[model samples]
Target chain A: MDRGGRMTAVVPTRATAPASGVRAAARIVAAPDGRGGTALPVLDGAGPLALRRTRAVAPGTAQVTVVGAMSAPLGGDHLSLDTRVRTGARLAVGSAAATVSLPGRCGRSATYDVRLTVDSDAELCWLPEPLIAAAGSDLAMTTRVDLAEGARLVLREELVLGRAGERPGRLVSRLTVRLDGRALLDQGLALGPGAPGWSGPAVLDRYRAVGQLLVVEPRFRDRPCQVAVLPSDPAEGEAMLTPLAGPAALVTALAEDALMVRRLLDAGRQAAAAAAG
Target chain B: MTITTTAPANRAALLVLADGRFPAGGHAHSGGAEAAVAAGRLYDATSLEAFCRGRLDTAGLVAAALAAAAAAGVDPLLLDEAADARTPSPALRATARKLGRQMMRAARACWPSPVLDALAAARPRGAHQPVVLGVTASAAGLGPLDAAHAAAYEAVSGPATAAVRLLSLDPFDATAVLARLAPDLDRVAQQAVDSARLALDSDVDALPAASAPLLEIAAERHAAWPVRLFAS
Candidate 1:
């Protein structure tokens, strides 16, 4: 397939040569139709990526799979993804899960970038599981999303600082969100800065882990809804961290300080749950 | 009402950030109230304050970062990108944009400055709450520390108010959370003031990479639910 064409495919097969890594490319071409829909293209390291129907699984279905791999293994290697969902079409993309190996002296890391384009009336949900970076490994990733007029897109990416057990020292991550040529969200984080206030009331308050989820659906526009957990009209589609129940209650009881709520967990789960609840 | 020429802009900035009525999409998020309720963690003001403080600390870092970035005259967009990087969960990012859009609306309504227009031009995008607050502070003639204070306060308030419902917190108890947080809020404001002087390296030392892991797990689990109340 032509590299410059709107719809193209590139896949490296084992027979082609004896390489350790695999490379694949797929594209979507939407005509002038007023309606939008997504074309699922099942990708393989050997053959051309083909379109398939969106798949669904049963409840309590928690399974993990690794779709592709590198042709050869080296001291440091990575995986990459480049995608663009056509306008008016809806797409939900996710990976089975990620398996990460620690980096040696080379200190090499794996990376992934996903570029999404949503046109008018189209919707996309890219909620992938957290990719754990083993100890001593450095990882960097970026997700660039472009939404056209009246388009809706939701892209979710989670990064585990280190495997729950492997326990990586530090994980650096970045994310950028844009719509209609305007940048809506840009965030960068480095979890291991051992400073004076590092784990104090002034900073993260010692939360060892971190995670966030972003959802952008135009359908919810002008609609007033509350999170299931916290059924309050969030003045804005936003909420931050509050103290944990244990610490907050204890502090207030002991110190007579109402702000005691400012002493507990970071904004990740506690805040989201409390606020959403 | 008495008026002071000393710094009328500071009061305005505070008002802009303080008013929960700002058009920013923040109204859409219950902070983690939804997640906490789902997790059975936040059931009352006792739990609500704890939840609010955690969010304040984690998100405060980002707000402080934005305040510092704005004080340094760095591009608000860059600060926004930095904020984005810090937030790993997609649900939170959506919440930010929703709030941002509202801030843009409020800014356009209350303060018709060029920066507000530029941000409005950016629309449903670009106009994140912190970025807009910083720029609006600049436009309204407030200092970085003051702007940071407003941003931090708003960050705290959004969740605190939501907790009232989740935990069935009494209005008096909820307001007490704010009053109690006074000293720390002042201290955080000072830190935000100091952070404004830091150089804009990708490191963003002003903030930390700490977030609630369980919250993320809940958000993911919440999104898949067929019927849910919160946007996060």
Candidate 2:
């Protein structure tokens, strides 16, 4: 963990789980090695988490994958992920599979906390799999991102309330995004059972899945991005796109199921990437 | 650093601010009720009540907390950022600032204050509606609880009023809907005040972050409506 070219020790900050449960933590830090290559001097994980860095897809860019046990139930599990992209570096992180959360034996809620930071002139694309909250399960997740001036980011989050024909469990998602010490976005939602009329027309209107794509770049603020409503395409669902005050744009879509949401999100990602470029 | 007194001088200011006909430009917006009505989701008194109740607990609670924090003397710029963070829809965010600018004009004419003037100067385009509301409440010598109550009441009252026009619901029923939710409004206002008090010692993130995704989505759709009675 080098701060301003100074070597700082990378400390393993692990969450203390109960004796009957499991806790996982992963940290990835990427920076420029000064030889036209990306350096990942800090990559570590603990518990039911694993991390791997692939070959650079582009100059000074690194691709990483976060893998968890396929058979192990994600009940009562606490997963913490920390990512940092230093100056002049780019990192793209994604998960290997969708997380199907289940009710823990101890009845404790599963949690995921992600903290991401991008330095000046850096970029990060976070494309995680959809989180499917199973019946009778409880899950809470939060994502906090800090970006420096001139940094760029494209982050996507997809959520599915439940499996087919099953009553969805509880899922609460919270996000806080800041640029240059100023908060740009702060949003929280509680979905599934006990949530207030989530399927109401003024809300989700019976949509079972939702996706959000956020793109932030210095150039986007100057462009006159149109905020239009597309016809409700049966396969694509409903989509709305809008540009924010600064270098940020947001796209929110709702669909009949996870596959449709993913389709919409994929299209949104392509559009946002092109706009950011 | 006591800029204003904790004790309110004008208890009736709450009533004045909470009035729907204060000429703050609130009449043009249905608070997403137009979208719901067009979608055939709110056609009767019962469904309108359900919609109002849902909004009061989520977006209403968040707005009340922001208002309470502003009345508690938090920085208006910070609260404006907090409001932006809480609002996910760009259309809604623009609507808030528009309403805020309109409210500032009225507040300046109604209650002249150096603080309000400073805020107006700082945010010439506008701040957020809840931020302006809290600041106006403070300028009017109202307390944090008063600001919270006003915010909470507006959350449901605007939609209820809009429903009357959109669905052609009876005025009596709309007013009755507000009356029935009075107890819930009080509870939400109290919770807002408590959250604001906590925010005083901690980060602004301590404020409530409750949100209604459908309302946010509907607002975006409503903003693009070619023929709509309400603005959002």
Candidate 3:
């Protein structure tokens, strides 16, 4: 059960989720707390799973980490993950470290799809470290969340262009996020080549960096941002976006009191400052 | 006791899903057509049709089913959460919520169903496009299958229609694209009806996983635009 039967130890297992390959995998670990809360289970030996010990961990700070590629991963082998935070549970899962790797060939990419569900009176935070797509590599990832009545979630994800010594321009990354059934957040980009928007005002504008965070909670509605950053809260959900600026267009909306101000910035510096807050 | 009138109730559900004016924020988005045009990936109706086809086969199909289910009296918020779990692109998810909000607005305006008000109250969860579509269709009295067809058609149409203004495609050709997709619309609609009957825990993995990578890339690239006209 190895490649061409040449190897014997790495056979794919039936216990794994369907469409899963050696490149990626995911699992859930949770046990109810004596008082009614629950503990998050570690995912596939990837690292420690983060769960709410009390109502103490701020909303936007949960994070988790999973190991990156070890050897040359083949096609059809991609990561799949799912997590559930039950009623009255609090959790934050962040990665231990950034993912690094030897870039794959052109036109090849690794895929990761994660599904998380939060129930009433529950809060979950996922602020994982950045993923480093090596030179000439392409990475495609999708993360989805389902929140029940009174549920809350805060998710943060980032990607670094080319790792270490590779030229930053040779990476391709695409990420999509959906809430409920309607397409909430969908974006994917392939860098390199004559990809029209390469230097255009309507595309990346030569920026090699991008980051996103989405928080869903009713409590987030009235909170105001002082400086660029908003502190994590238990009652509300917040999605704070930080663009590299770098000539790329910035589109954002922030609510103040009863009024919300949303504007686009032109320079990377201003965008960075705005993102920081 | 012979018969008074049931037209209003019969059409109530259909009105909820069919109206594009819903508060789901779909108006702010032109699908990827706006971004594709801005990126120059799309130049005319032909390319626009191709893009629509890809989306319909993947995201469009899912959104259609989810909405149709919601229309059939399923919980819109639950459907919204399920849809959210499926979308991976942060930007795309944001766009969906924006469109969802818009759909709600339209729904509240034209069809003030108690269910819609309840759904709206479940704010910040971001009512997805399909769930709202489903709930609205149910309120309108449209059959589940028919609702699915219309939902799919609209899902695909939104982007194709946007292409008209974004790429200078002849309106006639755009209409033709819509007309041509009729067969696909029916086929997918039937499939959705059948799939809806499956147990929630039934073999979802056995079903084909549909995804459109290129469109996703286009969306990501679209997010960074400095002066782009499209929201997603």
Candidate 4:
């Protein structure tokens, strides 16, 4: 039901999307090999969203990285990425560099939809690079992850308000994940345009870099992690880990720079790993 | 003979629910002000106003929308799930449900309704505070607008009062800060009502997802403090 509904919703948006910018659809599917290694049966990319296989971190894992083929995902563009890790397989997906959004001639906001499925006993690590919303750019991004029972995942998303020295463009992002058809987390954040007080003391607080890390494991249901602060430079930013209602925990951080933001999130990832271990 | 007629709306009932002494257990939580105070981000009324404004636009707006949706006679169960999705911080979620249970007890005492009873039976522990607030408004013969206003008011009022205690500042200054935020509160309530109405036709995702990441992070850290005045 959800899959059908999502596809229907994407159709209308894609149909009316500005014709002046690139519209891309991509997919990656990984399955387990009989020899206990992971194999990518399907790796397809279209338009500006290109995919390349990288060396595996472990013998049983397959790694893929997204390489931007062009300066795409501009205003009025519609982009979609679908990835599935089959049962018993492990896959890690990342990007080569930060995605920079620029204003296009279409004058409409760009849209990016990421859909991921992790089957039972499968593991997926989604660590994409930061998406920079430069001035005059308007983009809306949605990330949805569906996990079967016993699935494991580590997902991270980071946003950079603007480039080196300028006010940011409008960026609206939503992250929703479900485990066994139940909601684990659904958070929406709006920054840049149309979001008042985005940089206020209570929200971003003069910080430009913000991101969240979500980690999940089957054992968390029996032994949930504690809510605590992850150590980081006070001058850089702060980080915290809060267990979700399910077998997962979320780490949220805000920092003065993208590098610092990554550091805070990295600390969270390690803490989550150590706690789960 | 003196006449007693059922008015168009129980407008005065809204005041009772919105009262600070409503026995909802909200007074125990500082709404992140205690954390902000510890971090030295809020000192005088000036910084307090800024923090309240930011929170109102984000968390406050989201809560108002949830309350309005519940008051509009939507399924409380669905709205409860929606609330869970919007609240990413476990500390905040637990705090909301704890307060909801407290409010539920008071609502049952004040206004007896089968709907309230049904919701209580469904959520034996509790629902989200805003969802319960909306149902309580409905049981009291109020409308979605009233519920939205009440929630939006609570979002900042709790923190403002907490600051007075945490900072030992003048009570008058805190009240003044709320008075200045009256306009922002109105805007947030209106926005929430609009989103609630939209959610009636669409899914709950139509509601705003605005969040204060700093507020959430601070609340999580505050829960670990050795000794704190506020529960959240």
lDDT of 1 at B76: 65
Candidate 4 recovers a fraction of native contacts equal to 0.70
Greater-DockQ candidate between 2 and 3 = 2
Candidate 2 per-residue lDDT, tens place, B1-232, comes to 2323244678888788888889799999888899888767789998888788778878898999899889888888899988987887888999999999999999999889998899899999999999999999989889888999999999999999998888788999999999999999998998898888888877688888877767887888777778888888
lDDT of 2 by residue, A1-277 (tens): 1111211222112234353667678899999888876788898966666888866566667888777543223557788889999998889987767666667667778788999999999999898777777788788889999999899998988877776677787888888888998887777777887776466555566777887888888888677355645346734477666676667877777887777777666666566656666
Please give, for residues B18-66, the per-residue lDDT of candidate 1 as tens digits.
6787666676666666767765566766566666565555576567547
lDDT of the candidates, in the order given: 0.49, 0.80, 0.51, 0.85
Give the Cα RMSD of candidate 2: 6.5
Could you give candidate 1's per-residue lDDT for residues A220-240 as a string of tens digits? 344312332322222211222
Cα misplacement distance, residue B128 of candidate 4 (Å) = 1.7
- Listed per candidate, the RMSD to the true structure in angstroms reads 14.3, 6.5, 12.4, 6.8
Where is model 2 more than 4 Å wrong at Cα? A1-20, A55-59, A70-75, A234-236, B1-10
Q: Evaluated against the true chain A, what TM-score does chain A of model 1 have? A: 0.57
DockQ of each: 0.07, 0.53, 0.05, 0.61
A1-277: candidate 3 lDDT, tens digit per residue = 1111111122212333233334445665443465554555554543122222223354322234443323323223466677777677677776544543233323345666677777777777765655545555445556656666566665655544554345543334434333333333433444434232232222333333344445454543333222232222212211133221011112222111101111111122244434334
Candidate 2 chain A has its poorest 10 consecutive residues by lDDT at: A1-10
Best model per TM-score:
2
Tens digit per residue, CA lDDT, model 4, A43-127: 9987768999999887799999898776657887889999999999999998877777777776888999999999999999999
**A22, model 3: CA deviation in Å?**
18
